[model samples]
Target: MDPSSVIWIFFVFLFFYPQVLFRYRLLQRYKFIKQFEAVRKTRAIVMIHRQEQLALFGIPLYKYITIEDSEEILRAIRMTPEDMPIDLILHTPGGLVLASEQIAIALKEHKAKTTVIIPHYAMSGGSLIALAADEIIIDKNAVMGPVDPQIGQYPAASIINAINTKYTDELDDETLILGDIARKAIVQVKEFVYDILKDKMGEEKAKYLSETLSTGKWTHDYPLTINKLKDLGIEVNTELPNIVYELFDLYRQPVNQRPSVQYVPVPYKRGTKK
Candidate 1:
């Protein structure tokens, strides 16, 4: 072939290869999910967000739970039979309160058993949705964070603290306003958390969990380990299904993206050094 023809063919392969691979992966994921549903006899739903570059712009975008996510999840829940169980695989850093609450409330109202499996971490709003589940299945190393409300970039509790620590006259008008809104946000989220947990556990335990998770005692990104959760009477199961890890593998990081962490893909025995 002429050099010009060869160059054209290479460009075509580069452009078409990714598209073909993406479609194949999508189909494979669908098949795997269907098989999982069949084995578990439940409706399988996944809410995962990864930092990926846009196709046209190639600019990396961070993802969080959005209203669109809630809409789709709610629709899936509605389509499921009332008697069918739901398996929600959540991997998120968290998102909009309204969106998260919408999803949590719908899951709470589901007639069948609801299970949330966290293969890695489900922080903030993600943790809120987990509270509504009948069971939380998480990897032993996985973490969940406080559901404390964040006013803009600041934590609600911190905003309130700033106002209280300094006199009203010392604070800026906007700071004072944020403080007031922060207090209200805390109460609203605490109540919502209680509502989701009340029926699952008794009212007392529910209240405790609600306050602990939503009152902003810890930083927004504070990691709540399985042990800590269990200590708080969360009854979290650490026996995460192998298929869940497999499913997560399908939602891999974008191609051509560099990974910061790398290690041999094998389990190492204790006291064995590489």
Candidate 2:
């Protein structure tokens, strides 16, 4: 074929071979270096969801293992240069707390100077994991939610039901039982948040945050912002370097414009009983 004709054919081929286009995009991401190239070398990412909703802004991703697997986590640690610093990126709405906790603890225990980076929202159980990191970096637009642990969404609803019923129809034995469950849940969640804060902040501040967090009103309390974190004595680095800030703002554009800088989800089974 003539050179001009060959170019035309190549364009048509690429139009038909979309997977090639996708592979090309993946190739770009494979060697993708953040503006702060040094930081990307030792970074880990994790993402999460309750069910099959992996798409943030309708970007096609995965349902299960949407974040890093255990092996991947180890790989990130191992691949990181021994002398370089490391950062763990988390974008989770608080999945299995135990799983989140394990990841958080592992990141914490790693020998490298570790930092937790929250580019968007990390709430509930996810916040617990963020607490384990030595330092936490929350972008100006990013937020870490209150770590008020609960027994999933149903039991909490059931307890609320019992309270409403008790108020409407006076006390029944069943209502009283439900009341007990609700109270226990409140206390347990309170304690859980407290314990998490204790590790990140200290005992006194953890107690305060725990009580404030359980109200269900402050699950994603970003308004408190860095002030609240400071109150807890949780060290937060909110002011990013100007260049890093520029890169972060660029990376946060819609998925089409920005590659997924999200957690590589790992295969994780949700609790059947939960």
Candidate 3:
């Protein structure tokens, strides 16, 4: 072959390889989702996010639940039959309160049973959505987090408390304004949480949970373990299906940087040697 032709062929291969690989992975995900739906007889919706490298720039971009996510999820729920169950595969570090609440409310209003499956942690708004589920299936070691409202870079409860401690004359106008907004935000979120949980658990237990989770009892990022959640009277089960773990494998994070953790990717039986 001529030198020019060889170079052109190599460039064409490089250009098409990543696109082909990405399409193949997407197909694999859809296949597994269909399999899971067939086995469980439910509409399976995935809301997972990972830090992915952008094409060309290779810049890592983190994803969170957004308005767009809510729109799509809501549509998926609507398309499901009234009696069909819904299985939401959730994995996120939380996101916008409006988007999360929208999704949570939609799930809560669904006529059929709604299940939230957390293979890992679902913090902030993610936890809010999980609370709306009729059943929560999580990995034993996975976690949920507080739903305390945050205002800008500060916690809403903290802002209100801090303002209350200070003399009116000593606080700036912006501080006073922020405090007012913070109080409203906290009240709004607490009420929303209570509304979602009241029917699932009793009103009294729901009130306690709403207060504990939304009133800044802990930091927004605090991990609520399976035991802690159970202790708090939230009945979350640790019966994550094997297919969920397998599906998570397909949503791998971008490999633009050195991976922090490594392991032998195989199962071991105690009695049988490899």
Q: Output the number of the lDDT-best candidate.
A: 3
lDDT for model 2, please.
Answer: 0.56
- In the range 7-114, model 1's lDDT, one tens digit per residue, is 999999998888787767666677777777767777788888778888779898888988888888887787776777889989999999999999899999988899
Error of 1 at 9 (Å): 2.1
What is the TM-score of candidate 3?
A: 0.88
| lDDT (0 to 1) per candidate | 0.84, 0.56, 0.85
lDDT of 1: 0.84
What's the TM-score of every candidate structure?
A: 0.89, 0.60, 0.88
Give per-candidate clash totals.
0, 10, 0
Cα lDDT for residue 178, candidate 2: 62
lDDT of 3 by residue, 121-233 (tens): 99999999999999999999999999999999899988988888989999999999999899999999999999999987989999999999999999889999999998998
lDDT of 2 by residue, 152-251 (tens): 4544534665477546457777767666776776676676656655765678877776777664555343344677667756678886445444434433
Model 2 TM-score relative to the real fold = 0.60
Candidate RMSDs in Å, in order, are: 9.1, 8.8, 8.5
